[model samples]
Each structure stands twice: as structure tokens, then as C-alpha cells.
Target: MTANPARRSETSRQAILTAAFDLVGEVGYAKLSIEGIAARAGVGKQTIYRWWPSKGAVLFDAFLALMGGGPGDDAALPDTGDLAADLKTVLSATVDELNDPRFDEPMRALNTEIVHDAELAAAYAERLDLPMRELKRKRLRAAKEAGQLAADLDLDLAIDLLWGPLLNRWMQRGGPLTHEYVNALVDTALNGMRQGAPG
Candidate 1:
């Protein structure tokens, strides 16, 4: 009996993504190659090239999915009115995903490649980072609109204030991306960055 074409394609796609994750993790990102993922997934070189142009693209897609923000889901973000609480929850989830063994290799692949490959960096920024920035920015702006804080605020700066520190801490490995550390980050961000207290 013949299998369904869509099902077969999905199976192949999933296999390729999984193989990319393992290869990027086992070998450093620079060492990862299309030949490697194709071989690991038991697919032809053309199969990978046909779907994804570069290892960075594959890695970005794989890790973003692992982070619960994949397959065009990057536009999704939680906004619970309380900016502090919302950011804390979202960033904490991000921390958990980053620290997961399943996610470690692919994320590292994406992050490192962005440093050296301008094209890949641009794609990654467009596909992943911009969404993250938008999500956080929207939440902060909403907080301001709700009169949760003062007016005439710089929303981008506000996002940077709350979001960048956690990212900085993680990228620098300043400390464990622990819940305590993340909560501290959220607290520091809200207290230090908020424009003014509510009346």
C-alpha cells in the first residue's frame, strides 16, 4: 500500500529537523554540514537543500520549535496586564527552554552562527529576534497604555531594560538561568526600568 504523501513528507521533515538538532549539538555549529544532517536523517542532500538553504536556517527552525515558538509561532506572546508578572513568566519559560538538553545544541548553533554569518544573522533576526522584541515591546506598551505606569515612555528602551538583562545574563553565563535568577532579573527590570510608580 502506498503511504500518504503529506504524511511521508512530514515524517521526513521531522526526521531532518531531529537530525539537525543532534548533529549541531554533537559537533559544534561550524562543523555541522548539510551532508551531516542528510546522512543522519537518511535523506538525500537534495532533500535538505530543497527545503532549507543553510544549516543556520535548519537550526533556527528546529530550536525555535523546541522553545514552543516555532513554525510561525514566534508571533505568539503572553500578556497578562501586569508587565512584571508577564515578563517574568515568559522569560522564565525562555530560560527553561534554553537550559534544556534537547534545546542546548540548536540554540547554540543559532546564536553562534549569527555572530559570523551576516545573511544568516539577518534571517535569524527577522525570524526569531524581531518577534521576541515585538512581543516584549507590545506587552510593555500595553502596560503604559493601561496607566500601569507613566506616559511619554520609550517602549523600545523599556523592552531593552526588562528583556536585555536576562538575555545578557544568559549569553554571558553570569549565573545560572535559575528561577531565582530569572525572578531577580524580572524584579530588577521592573523596579529599575519602570518610568514611574502608579498613583
Candidate 2:
């Protein structure tokens, strides 16, 4: 019987992504390399280059795979009708994820790569950032309809306002990422929007 090339390719791809994900965590991104990843995955370096343009790209895909995010995955935020509560819930979970030690090194590494690599940044924005933002917008849009937020709120700017501080704090290591902090951020952002909203 002939081996199935498609199945074999999928297996190799999975192995490579897993290896990249694990290696970045174990060794940190500064020390990660294509040769190291290939050896860890038990595949040729060519296989990785065949699929990804660089180590940063590989790491980005690996991060996405680990997070279960992709083109077709559900990225919805909680929309329980209470906009502030829902935002707090979602942002609190984000705080937990950002503070998780297992994800700390890898996330920092990915962020660093994104900052320096234009291609990887573009991929991250398209595949992860935009989708997540749209999902958030969907939740906020619902809240707007329910009179919880401004009807004319700029959803994109609102998303950024709610999330930007948290992200900046985490990336800058300015303070602890806690649920309380997330709640404050949610409250503050929502309050500002509501005040500007036409009653």
C-alpha cells in the first residue's frame, strides 16, 4: 500500500508547529532557529522553509495553533446584554491568559517578532487581530442596540480604548495584570463612551 502524501504532510505540519510552539517556550525566541525546530520536529529544514518564510512566521502560526485561533474558528466575545459586565468577563480571561507563566515567554517572543518583522505583523493583524476585533465589535454592536453604549460609537476605536491600556501595561511590564485591573479598564472605557452617547 502506498503511503498517503496528504496525511503525511499534515502530520509533518502539525509536528513542526508543535515543535515551534514548544521550543519558543522552552528556549525563548532569541535562541529559536529553523534548524532547531526542524530537528525537534524530526523534519528537514526545507519542510519548514517550504511552509513559512521565517522563524517569526513559524512562531506566529504556532501561537495561533496553540490558541486554537485560525481563519474559520469562532472568535466571539461574551454578549450577555450587559456590555460592561461582558467586557469585564472577556478582558478578565485575557488577563488570566496574559499572566499565565506558560504563555508569558512565548507571547513576549511573539510580540517582539511582530514588532520587528513587518510580514509577521501583517499576518498577525489579519489572522488574529482583525478577527478578534470584529468579534468584539459584534458584542459591542449588540450592546449599542440595547442602549448600553453609544449608538454612534466608533467600534474600532472603542475596542482599542478598552484593550490598548491592558496590552500596553502587559507589554511594558508596567503593572500586574489582574481581574481588578481589567474591570477598571472596562468600566472606564464604557463610562466614557456612555457619557458621549446621545440619550
Candidate 3:
């Protein structure tokens, strides 16, 4: 009996992605290489190269795979009617993921690649950022329709105001990314936006 070619190829791809993700966490992205990932995955180097153009590309896909799904898959944030509580819940989960040791190094490496690689940046924006931002905006739009946010609030600006500080703080290590911290952010942003809403 012969193994299905498609199944075998999928297995190899999964192995390669898992190996890349684990190696980046253990060795850091600067020391990670296709050969090392191939060795760890027990696949040939040619197999990796055939699937991914560079180590960074492999790392990106590995990160995405570990995340379980890509954009458009789970497109909604939890909308529990109370916008503040919902944002706090989601952002708190983000803090946990960012602070996690297993995810920290690979996420940092992916951000670095997105910064320097134009093509990767475009792919990331198309596949990840845009979808996530749309989810945020969808929630915010719901709140606005409910008169919880400013009638004229620019959803994009609102998104930035809510998220930019946390992102900056995390990337700069300027402060602890605690649930309390994110709750505070959610409260502060929502308070201001609510105040700005027409009475």
C-alpha cells in the first residue's frame, strides 16, 4: 500500500512549520536557518525551499499555523453588548499571548521581518492586519450604532487610540502588559469616546 501523496505532503508541511516555530523559540530567529528547521522536521532542505522562499517566510507561516487559522476564519471579537468589558476581555487575552514565552520570540521576529520586507508586510497586512482591524472596527461600529461611542468617531482613529498605546508599550517593554493595564486602556478610551458622543 502506498501513502497518499497529498497526505504525505501535508504531513511534511506541518512538520516543517512546527519545527520552524519551535526552533525560533529555542534558538531565536537570528540563529534560525532552513537547514536547522529541515533537520528538526526530518525533511530535506529542498522540501522547505520548495514551500517557502526564505527562513522568514517559513517563520511567518509557522506562526500563522500555530495560531490555528488565518484571516476571515474567526472574524468577530466577542460582542457582549458591553463594549468596555468586551474590549478588555479581548485585549487581556492579547496581553497574555504577547507575554507568553513560547510566542514572544517568534512574534518579535515576525514583526522585524514585516518591518523590513515589503512583500511580507503586504502579505501580513492583507492576511492578518486588515482582517483584525476589520474585526475591531466591526465591534466599534456596533457600539457607535448603539450610541455608546461618538456619533462622528472615525473608526480608524478610534482603533488606533485604543490599540496604539498597548502595542507601543509591548514593543518597547515600557510597562507590564497586565489585564488590569488593558482594562484601564479600555476604560479610558471608551470613556473619552462616550463623552464625545452627542447628548
Candidate achieving the largest lDDT: 3
What is the alpha-carbon lDDT of model 2 when measured against the actual structure? Answer: 0.87
Q: In model 1, which regions exceed 4 Å deviation?
A: 1-6, 67-76, 195-199
Q: Is 2 or 3 the stronger prediction by TM-score?
A: 3
Tell me how many clashing residue pairs each candidate has: 0, 0, 0
Q: What digit string (tens of lDDT, one per residue) describes model 1 on residues 47-156?
A: 88898888888887777666565336446467766777777788788789879876766676677788988988888788777877777677777888787756777778
RMSD of 2: 2.0
Residues 25-93 of candidate 3 have per-residue lDDT tens digits of 999988999999999999999999998889998988887787666755666999999999899988989
Per-model TM values vs. the true structure: 0.84, 0.92, 0.95
Enumerate residue pairs that collide in model 1. Answer: none
Q: Which pairs clash inside model 3?
A: none
Instruction: Using TM-score, rank the candidates from best to worst.
Output: 3, 2, 1
Candidate 2 lDDT at 82 equals: 78
Winner on TM-score (1 vs 3): 3
Which runs in model 3 stand beyond 4 Å of their true positions? 195-199
